[model samples]
Target: MGKLRVKVDLALCQGHAVCMQEAPEVFRVNETDGHYPKVEVILEFPPEDLREKVMDAVRYCPNRTISVEEIPD
Candidate 1:
């Protein structure tokens, strides 16, 4: 399997946790008292086995802020 990188743009993200729900291993969103933080964190390199789910998260993002790219080892 190949390596992949994930990234999220906070400016474009509206606190939607779709990516988080789809790929919790790759994306994270902190919640506080029912309110979610504006920033979303993307893991640098998710497990190669999770590529399909990561791609699903990318497609599920409404703002299209999520990005996944294959990296050279």
Candidate 2:
């Protein structure tokens, strides 16, 4: 699998958990101080097979805070 980088914008994320729903293996949400939970990446460099799932999270993020970039060799 090719290398990849993933990031989530905490300021923009609403903890909707759509990313987690799309790729639970790569994303999760953490409740913070009783406020809306925050999104987290469980796997920054997911396997090749899970690439699509990661992309799905990026696409499905309600706030468009999720981003995944390919790392060139």
Candidate 3:
């Protein structure tokens, strides 16, 4: 399988944390003081083993802010 490049659109993220729930190893939801919570990509290029979970995050994101691109390995 090719490498996975994950991305999150912070402007569209509402901090639902669905992506985190789906793939904690690849995504993080940080809620800081005085700022709206946002989702962060913990692993921009996760291992092939985590591809399914990462894809789940992309598929289940409530705001549709998560995306993945396959890069030639």
| Per-candidate local distance difference test | 0.78, 0.88, 0.88
Instruction: Score every model by TM-score.
Output: 0.79, 0.91, 0.92
* TM-score, model 1 to reference: 0.79
Give stretches of model 1 more than 4 Å off.
32-36
Q: Tens-digit lDDT track for model 3 on 1-73?
A: 6788998788999888898888999888999678778988888989989999998988888789988888987
- From the highest TM-score down, the ranking of the candidates is 3, 2, 1
Better of 1 and 2 by lDDT: 2
> Where in model 3 is the C-alpha error above 4 Å?
none
lDDT tens digits by residue: candidate 1, 1-73: 4588887777787768888898888778776565546545657788878888889988988889888677877
What RMSD, rounded to one decimal, does every model reach?
A: 2.6, 1.3, 1.1
Query: Candidate 2, residues 43-67: lDDT per residue as tens digits?
Result: 9888788988888889889899998
